[model samples]
Target: MYEASDLKKGIKIELEGEPYIITDFEFSKPGKGQAIYRVRMKNLLTGYSIDKSYRSNDKFQPANVSNLKLQYSYFDGTNYVFMDPETFENYSVNADLMEDKKDYLMENMEVDGTLYNEMVIDVTLPSFVEMKVMRSDPGVKGDTATNATKPATMETGLEIKVPLFVNEGDVIRIDTRTGEYLARVSTK
Candidate 1:
């Protein structure tokens, strides 16, 4: 059990019999009233989010989540498959559950999978991923003067606006959170 005042980002707890992860939290102490906590929580299983407030003394039971380090094996066309490094057991997750993570995941990449009561709830891909550009237009010779960007497709079929200097066949770093291009990675 934990008090509302102890809530922090990444903390998991149960509310209304559903497991949720605290994405952001703020503690507010009213000058003349009671202390309250405002939290933005996302459903661990469904990916839904809501803003809720709790009194300082409100107690909650921490949700039990099993986090495992898994290796991306291969996709079965419909679902992406991952294997537990420890047990060598494989698990397949639906594409909808993977959402934005699909852009960053490559063959043999390592990712973290969250399980609620042993049921896979979510998968977190790396913050930054290296992917090769599969398609892009030619850059203008003097386009480097301004902060211009051109759309490029990565090997995973994800399109992102990369700098004008980028070209097809170039390996670039991508920011997974915003699905933006970071920079070109040196082949050397």
Candidate 2:
């Protein structure tokens, strides 16, 4: 159990019998009123977000989530499959659960998944991933005059804006969170 006064960002709690992860929180004490907390939270299962306020003394049950390191095995159209390295157990999660991170998934790559009551809620991919550039136009000579960027397609079928120097067949480092190009991995 946790008091509203102790609420902080990233803290998970139960509200109305549903699990919500704190996305943002603010502590306020109005001039004429008692201390209160304004919080923004996202539903772990559905990804819906809402804002609510709580009085300082209000209490709520803290949600406990477990994380496991799993490997990307395959995807069967509707659901993506993952394997637990330790127990060799398999879990199939919906595409919505993976969201934009699906583009970064690679076979045998290590991924982190959050579980609540043995159900997977979220998946976290590495900060940076190596991907092959599948398509891009030729860069104009002397294009270094500006920091201009062009769109490039990756092997995973995700398109990202990269510098003009990028070309097809080049492997690059990509920041999965922002879906941006980090740097060219190699020229060849």
Candidate 3:
């Protein structure tokens, strides 16, 4: 249990049987009336945002949330498996929760995973990942135009644009957030 005055950004609480994390918060007093707590929160289960105002007497239930550093194991069709490096325990996340993130995950890579009420909810991958270009067409001769790029297929099946100079069997760094090419890391 927490009092309204205790609310702060990054705090997790339960509302209507769902867990929410406060993304922004502010405390205000009207000089005469009671204090109010304003908060902007995101629903952990549905990824929705909402705003609410609470009176000084309002109380809240603290949500049970935990984070772990887990290593990628494999996708088991219905769920993505991750292993606790120190304990050797496995946690499975629903495949739907991994949608776009699967492209950036590599075998045995370490990632931060968030669990709410013991249910896996969120995963954070590295900012940059090194991926191998499995196949890419040769750059056109004399096509020296600035910022020129060609299509490429990565080992994970993520299609991205790489500099014309890049070719098959080359390892490149990718910015996971934007899914953009950073630079060629190596050539095989």
TM-scores vs. true structure, each candidate: 0.76, 0.80, 0.96
* Candidate 3: residue 97 lDDT (0-100): 88
Candidate 1 lDDT over 1-188, as tens digits, reads 99998899999999888899999999888899898899999987777999999998899999988799989998899998999989998888888888767877888899999877766678888888999999999887866667788888988889899888787898999888888877889542
Per-residue alpha-carbon lDDT of candidate 2 for residues 3-102, written as tens digits (9 for 90 to 100) = 9988899899988877899999998888998988999999887789999999988998987677899899999999999999999998898888776788
> Considering lDDT, which of the candidate structures 1 and 2 is the better prediction for this target?
2
Please give the ranking of all candidate structures by lDDT, highest first, separated by commas.
3, 2, 1
What are the lDDT scores of the predictions, listed in order? 0.87, 0.88, 0.92
TM-score of 3: 0.96
lDDT of residue 181 for candidate 2? 85
Name the candidate that leads on lDDT.
3
Error of 1 at 160 (Å): 1.2
Candidate 2 TM-score, true structure as reference: 0.80
Backbone collisions counted per model: 0, 0, 0
Q: List the residue pairs that clash in candidate 3.
A: none
Give the Å error, residue 116, model 2: 1.7
lDDT value, residue 41 of candidate 3? 99
What is candidate 3's lDDT per residue for 44-155, written digit by digit as tens? Answer: 9999999999997799999998899999999988999999899998999998889989987889999999988777899989899999999999999999998999999999
